[model samples]
Target: MSINAKSADHSPIDEDAEQLARLGYTYEKQFKREMSFWGNVSLGFTYLSPVVGVYTLFASSLGLGGPPMIWSFLIVGVGQFFVALVFGEIVSNYPVAGGIYPWARRLWGRKWGWMTGWVYLIALLTTIAGVAYGAGTFLDALVGAEASTASTIVCAIVMILLATGINLGGTKLLNKVAMLGLIAELSGALVVGIWLLVVARQHDLSVLFNSFGAGGGSNYFIAFAAAALIGIYQYYGFEACGDVAEEVPNPGIRIPKAMRMTIYIGGFAATFVCLSLILAVPDYAAVISGQDTDPVGTVLSGAFGAVGYRVVLGIVLISFVSCVMSLQAAASRLSYSMARDRMLPASKLLAHFQEKRHVPPYSLLLACVVPILVILGSIVSPDALVVIVSFAALGIYLGFQLVVLAALRARLKGWKPSGAFQLGKWGVPVNIAALTWGVLGITNMVWPRTPDSPWFVNYLVLLSAVAVVGVGLIYLFAKKPYTHSDAPAADAVPPSGSNRSVAENAQSHHVENYL
Candidate 1:
């Protein structure tokens, strides 16, 4: 039996365990000592991928080149940081695997939490598909292979399966693999970026700063706004660290620190890469015009020749694949956490962890299978990846907004968590600011692009809206909320008496696992 399941005979199954049984599952604390702070941070940071840097090419294509693109990235990065802080404060205090879902419930109430959880869950799943599909596209570019919808779909499935296999090996293995991949990704990006900057040192850096009117045809603000949508996406996925807070030791301290590191490091790295790619462009028009294939690769091929181009392509592929793996790890933990809470159907199966592996085998399997199908099925339309990614972003934005608002309200009502991290006096204003920015981003993303808009990319405002509503409805009627004491096998002891946060207890069993 897993170390956690073995613990069942020694101690009384807590109220939480009882609740888990209602959903047809048994809670197993299977993942412990599996990830360090840096490893967890790396998982979240890798998701940005080349997607953020490549976003600049699209920005340029839409006519919002020059200073505007750089400024847009800066603006989005800072704005998103506020949201991260809100997450950090709560996650550190709770450090539970349910993450946004449990935080929402604690701060708001059961009904709102249930609704928000579904949206967060679906968004996370779709985000996995979007990142995996992008990995396939980058791999295709590296191999000089033509990627049709069918080919991309098949590649996505293959990549997802590989990622799942890695995760099934347990969090320790997953963290090690993720750390290695992260180093390669960052190292490769830096090598190319620095090399390009050094070679182009004599070029007029001012030219890179000059703003070009949206291709001379679209609205300047709207163009910049569109670029901001792309820019803002780069700053996300930092919260993935919190979803597996239970697996990390000293989670109250480590989880918050890890989250802060991800936000600051990821934000700076994304901005640096975006700027470096733009400055490396010998001819912006040529780079922007080649979106039919790989715009970033086109620029690299011209600027550094075939070898340099191939190297960049290879790095992009590796980074994207790493991102897919990281997403699977996070998504599976989220599903497992929710299932253990009796909030999802088939909870027993979905939440089960293997004793010898100390891994959520079923959850990992589900996470991998769902994304492959999503990537394959969604590849038929033009700009399928962009639409899906944006659609996924909307869900994340909503979840973040809700959590921030909930936290603010809870604090105002005198709810103070005695924990390792607390915002003190700055919490309310920061949360308010975060909420404003989130609302603006959602509205801007949903706003349609006009024929005269600088960014010509199609928006999936309607589809994204439909998805959020659909998820909310499903939660309203189908998902059931459970009391902490409802589960049969869990120690239902309150956090105060147990000296363990819900997340720590849920994930503490893996520490003794080596088999």
Candidate 2:
């Protein structure tokens, strides 16, 4: 566990090990650094899967805000890029396994990290269930099987089991599948988008600006804000890159670059796909007026004929499987990271890693089981499932903003980022912008827009956020899990003016002050 001269070795693998050692943890040889830069990017891109995002939200977005809702991609994309930059800075410095948990722990304190991870962990589980359920609907379509609540739930459980099996194969298999997913998904998106734009265009370019009375009068911004969920949900898959930091060589340098690549590339693909779908819609009035509840299917079926539409459906299914696999992998890693620190109940079991496969078996199983339970719980009321799934995007943003807030707090406390990729003077402004955008985005998402629905349904997002945080706080104080860990805390090192490296500073300070 001690840093030696080898810690100074400049080779990527050695440097990564050295970096982990510097962070007060021994290098875990179980996690071989098998993911290359592109593999890392693929995990993130597939997780972000433009196909999944657009297809899932398209009808609702179009109904709520018309063609102009497409702009949410650009707006949320820009804002998330700022968030990605903030993440890149933190991951460059920490390069730890858990994306937000370890980053928050190092930046703030143990309790802050626990709450952030708790909320994010629930969000990830909810997202897995949501994605799996969506995939089941597509699976039904591709197979020409009748879609029903029972059938979709069965298909979703199958998808979850399949993803779990693949994930248990370890990071190497995860990397290969992620890369393949990236190729299939990206190519499918490009092909479908180009075909729709060139061969099936029903509306002119200016159609994007037309809202078709979507705002219910002169309050278009209200509608636009509601539709922004399309982008908010799509842009977050970038952080999956850092979730497996130990499995990527030169993580401090490579992971940051991979993160930015996910945003830049994923954003463009999502926007292009959204735009093409918008232009290809044969009748915007029908979509806006609720006459066409399934515009995506209508467009694909009309433009591609029966056989070609089925072919596209197959590609979409692949994207969904890839997305589910990537999400499960990330969820397991986060679980493992937290459990390794003895943060969660049954920590020892959850933290157990398979020596030969370099995988956290219990953690992976936990990830798989939780989502299936969630899916099964929804059988009584399918609408209840939708309400729970709706909290996914908001929960993710809250987790992200907590990290951003932690970074800002660390910065104000005179902590300078000393990673391979520091933002230098630009750090503060970028952090501020990211935080501001996150607050606005969260507010927009939680706003009770549906007047006709029950009050609980409209305020579900806010209520869910408060409920999750409230539970976490109650547990935090009642059990005081943070006190059990010997891991380094926020005050382990002096402020930025210190000449010594964080590793050296941490080595000198006693690990104390849990309260």
Alpha-carbon local distance difference test for all models: 0.67, 0.87
- In angstroms, give how far residue 494 of model 2 lies from its true place: 2.3
Assess candidate 1 and give its lDDT: 0.67
What overall lDDT, based on C-alpha atoms, would model 2 receive against the true structure?
Answer: 0.87
lDDT for 116 in candidate 2 is 90
| TM-scores for the candidates | 0.83, 0.95
Cα RMSDs, all models: 6.9, 4.3
lDDT digits (tens) for residues 142-241 of candidate 1: 6788877777777778878888888888878888887887788778767777876777432455754555444356556666676666576677777888
State the lDDT at 194 in candidate 2.
Answer: 97
Runs off by more than 4 Å, candidate 1: 1-28, 50-67, 200-203, 215-219, 286-294, 378-390, 451-459, 478-515
Q: In model 2, which regions exceed 4 Å deviation?
A: 1-11, 27-29, 491-515
Among all candidates shown, the one with the greatest TM-score:
2
Q: Please, what are the lDDT tens digits per residue for candidate 2 over residues 117-179?
A: 999998999999999988877878888888888888898899889989988998899999999
